[model samples]
Target: MKIQTKINGHLREDEVEPRLLLVHYLRDVAGLTGTHIGCETSLCGACTVLLNGEAVKSCTLFAVQADGGEITTIEALGNHEKLHPLQEGFWEEHGLQCGFCTPGMILAAYQLLCRNPHPSREEIRKGLEGNLCRCTGYQHIVKAIEYAAQKIGSPDA
Candidate 1:
């Protein structure tokens, strides 16, 4: 199958198997390794990405399912020189230990802040329930999200 989609602000068309998982397409085909494949069962949020502005588990969807859609992987967020607030938050708050789940967690939190720029700690917890992190005990992750919310909502940001 030939699928065309916009990824990380670039339009790309590629031939892929109909059964190819989106996570595989991103990592193998598109060469975007930031979107990790933790639990292919979708139990782990390590495969999360923004599909058409909404966060979805890439492991749960086929590449063809994202045809004609806009996808944002963790690489699109920011670079080393300029980091997105979420990325900065993660770094500042030490939100990740192993760092395997950082990308998905940041993307999930990105969608959360987009929907509710100012999410309460509880709401942040609820918002990120879909993602699970074995390291950091989630306290630092919550603090990271809060840091991002404050930075994003601030005029200086």
Candidate 2:
């Protein structure tokens, strides 16, 4: 199958097997390794990425399904020079321990903050219910989202 999709603001056209998972396409073909593969099942959001501006688990969808769509992996979120607000929030708030789930957590939080720029702690918790982190126990993760929300809601941000 020939899949053509815009990933991380770049247009990608590649030959892939029908069974190729979107996660593999991003990691193997697209050379974006930021999206991690934890369980390969949808239960773990470690493989999460934004598909057409909404976060979706890359491991659950086939690459062919993403053809002609736009995907945003963690690589597109920020670079070394300037970090995304969420990335900075994670760093400032110590939101991660192992760092395996940070990308997915940030992406999920990205969608949350996009919809609700001033989300309360409860709302933030609810928004990130789909993504799990074994290291931080979610306290720091919530703080990280809150930090990003504050930064985004601020005029200076």
lDDT of 2 by residue, 81-147 (tens): 9999999999999999999998999999999988888999999999998898998889999999888
Best by TM-score: 1
Compute the lDDT of residue 53 as modeled in candidate 1. 100
Residues 63-132 of candidate 1 have per-residue lDDT tens digits of: 9999999999999999999999999999999999999999999999999999999999999999999999
Steric clash pairs (candidate 2):
none
Model 1, poorest ten-residue lDDT window?
A: 36-45
Local distance difference test, candidate 1: 0.96
TM-score of 1: 0.99
RMSD of each: 0.5, 0.7
**Alpha-carbon local distance difference test for all models:** 0.96, 0.92
Error of 2 at 98 (Å): 0.6
